[model samples]
Target: MITSPDNDNNRDEPMVFIVIAKAYETEGGQPIDLHVMLTAPDDDTAVRLTLNALSEEGFLEADLDQIGMITGAPDEEPHASAYQGALEGEVAIIRFA
Candidate 1:
């Protein structure tokens, strides 16, 4: 499990977050759907980590729509894979082309 560098939540387990966002790769360009899944100690940390990850992934700007916590791993494709990746300390992103 991965937590933000500044996270102070002392929980032993990481909380899974699913963030829905619209991102732009270029100025004035069309928006892209960027859904992310990751583990963090808290909601604030999760948002921060997601923003940083988006920047690192080359997104110029992003507008987050929602952030939800997952009580259990998903049983579907894509989401299931993303959830597993989050457990292994990765910021898993799902994109639709």
Candidate 2:
């Protein structure tokens, strides 16, 4: 979990963010998808933290840009399958009604 510092008047509670990384195998160019959960104060911070974490783990940023989605509420479980194969590959924060 990564978070900005809390100030006297603002308390930033941790929120769950889903991260999907498109990783390729070193041997045959096979693609392995990764679905992960990250905790942060907000969606933007979540993406930044996720990118940092992935980079530390040796995943390239270009490969990572393939898929990134923030799903579920702070108390809800994320459904990773629902957003698979998304073409746009844009950053999204989705909440159920």
Best candidate per TM-score, number? 1
Candidate 1 lDDT over residue span 42-78, tens digit each: 8899999999999999999999999999888889989
**Least well predicted 10-residue stretch by lDDT in candidate 2:** 82-91
Clashing pairs in 1: none
The 0-to-1 C-alpha lDDT of every candidate, in the order given, reads 0.92, 0.48
| Candidate that scores best on lDDT | 1
Q: Which 10 residues in a row give candidate 1 its minimum summed lDDT?
A: 2-11
Candidate 2, residues 67-90: lDDT per residue as tens digits?
A: 243444333334443233121233
For model 1, the local distance difference test gives 0.92
| Candidate 2 residue-wise lDDT at 37 | 60
Candidate 1 RMSD to the correct structure? 6.5
**TM-score (all chains, Cα) for each model:** 0.85, 0.44
